[model samples]
Target: MTHIYNDPRGFKEDMIEGFVRAHRDRVRRVPNASAVMSSRAPVKGKVALIIGGGSGHYPAFCGLVGEGLADAAVIGDIFTSPSAEQVYRCTKAVEGGAGVVYSFGNYSGDVMHFGLAEMRCESEGIDVRTVLVTDDVASAPPEQREDRRGIAGDLYVFKVAGASAHRGDPLDEVERLARKANDHTRTVGVAFGGCTLPGKSEPLFRVDPGRMEFGLGIHGEPGVSTSELLPAPELARLLVGKLLEEAPPDADGTVALMLNGLGSTKYEELFVLYRYVSELVERAGLRIHHPLVGEYVTSLDMAGCSLTFLWLDEELRELHDAPARTPAMIWEVKR
Candidate 1:
């Protein structure tokens, strides 16, 4: 059973209470809302990079709010999209003279609500743009890639946009690079078990004993395939193969790799997986840049992992290498 909380219905609000309190120096509540914004917001001449999505994925929607990442996050309840009103508040709070760039995973509810917020911003004379991260290659076929869902690759897109914005790039430039980041990125994941929502006693789904599921969703959805649990090396081969297969032919041989643990997967297990993944990327004739191995995006205690590859050009590599200081990730610019 999922553990630790007060009232089941009050879970989201209580979590927010604890979050902002602990990170008071870094973030603050959006006032009468479940949203959060970087303490250092509203940089007068720069574009604002606002991100949002469901709760549960900590250090993501909220943890990403700081310099060189997200300027604000319109948060929502577990696995649910934030409301249109919430989106507007965060947008208005962060908009500088340049404009606002709204970035988030490609989800139906998020698309609907963020759209509503966009129209409202335009009517209010605030410039706005959007870049939806659709880097989950397993969600759709190559010919229909736009229909794919966004998963762990959301971080790459958001990070690039935030860095661009931080550098005082205009809204259009930030939006373009973020879309480009999404185009250059791919992710494939496997799950050993499903996650349980807060207040629920049973997991949303389950893998049979001695097996694992592949191409799974972050919100505990079933994957595309299930087979006997393989060793870390074989699992790494399967995931890396799918990503490289779908990568664009023009993709440069350099990649920013993210080996993410989906909640319950231990770090020691991830380190083992990363050892194999690092070798596989090298074997595929790709150079690794800013390779990360840990939980950046995650499901709620779901025991599994995913590998994300962001094939990079000179521009992408520079943006990624720039300094980024967030609650969960702190990357210093190379001297």
Candidate 2:
């Protein structure tokens, strides 16, 4: 059960309040809106990269705002999409005249709301584009990849989009790179338990003892299927197998990888899993490029983890290695 809150309805607001306070050096709250912008936003002549979704996924919408990442992030209530007005306000605050690119998970609400804001911005003569992240392999078949939900793959799409924008790439190129990143990425997750909302006494869903839910959603949704819990190494094989089955057609054997914990999973446990995960990827004739193992996107207190693969080309590799300093992630230039 979730604990420590004044009012359940105000959870998102309270969280944002504390977040901006803690990261004041890197981000600032957008006035009169549920959004945050980088301290150096509105960089003239540079495309503005904006990403957003529900508030529960930290370090995603807000934590990603800083140098070399998203210029702004519009946040919404827990597990809900931000309103179009809030998105529009955020766009006005950081457009910078170069154009704006909005990237977010392919959830229906986010697509509709962000699309509205995109239209409004373009109507006012501000160039704006939208790139949806659809990388969850379990949500759709390979023939219908565009219909898959976006899970941990948000990181790859956002990273490429932000790097492209930060390097002063033209708006068209930024949008293209973002789309390419999404196209090359795929993910699958497993849930060991469910998360409870603030002030709730019961979890959104429950997994039976000794069993696990595979392909869990980040918004308290149940997994696509369930099975007996396997040992860490076996679990690692299951995840890697699912991804490799749908590896992108142009996969060049080099991939950017992430083993993301979904809230309650311990970092130590993820490391144990990654040990076998790394080995299996190499055994499959793939080179892991700067693989990450930690929580990048998460459901509040959910016991689960997802693995993501971003098949990289030369350009994507360079962008993935670019320097970025954000509240949640810090990547430095390779010497």
lDDT of 1 by residue, 229-275 (tens): 99988988998899889777778798999999989898999999999
**lDDT, residue 47, model 1:** 93
Which portions of model 1 show Cα errors greater than 4 Å? 333-335
Instruction: Give the 10-residue window scoring lowest on summed lDDT in candidate 1.
Output: 326-335
Top TM-score prediction, candidate number: 2
TM-score for candidate 1: 0.98
Q: What is the lDDT of residue 108 in candidate 2?
A: 95
Among these predictions, the greatest lDDT belongs to: 2
lDDT for 87 in candidate 2 is 98
lDDT of 2 by residue, 77-121 (tens): 988999999999999999999999999999999999999999999
TM-score of 2: 0.98
Candidate 2 weakest ten by summed lDDT: 326-335
TM-score of each: 0.98, 0.98
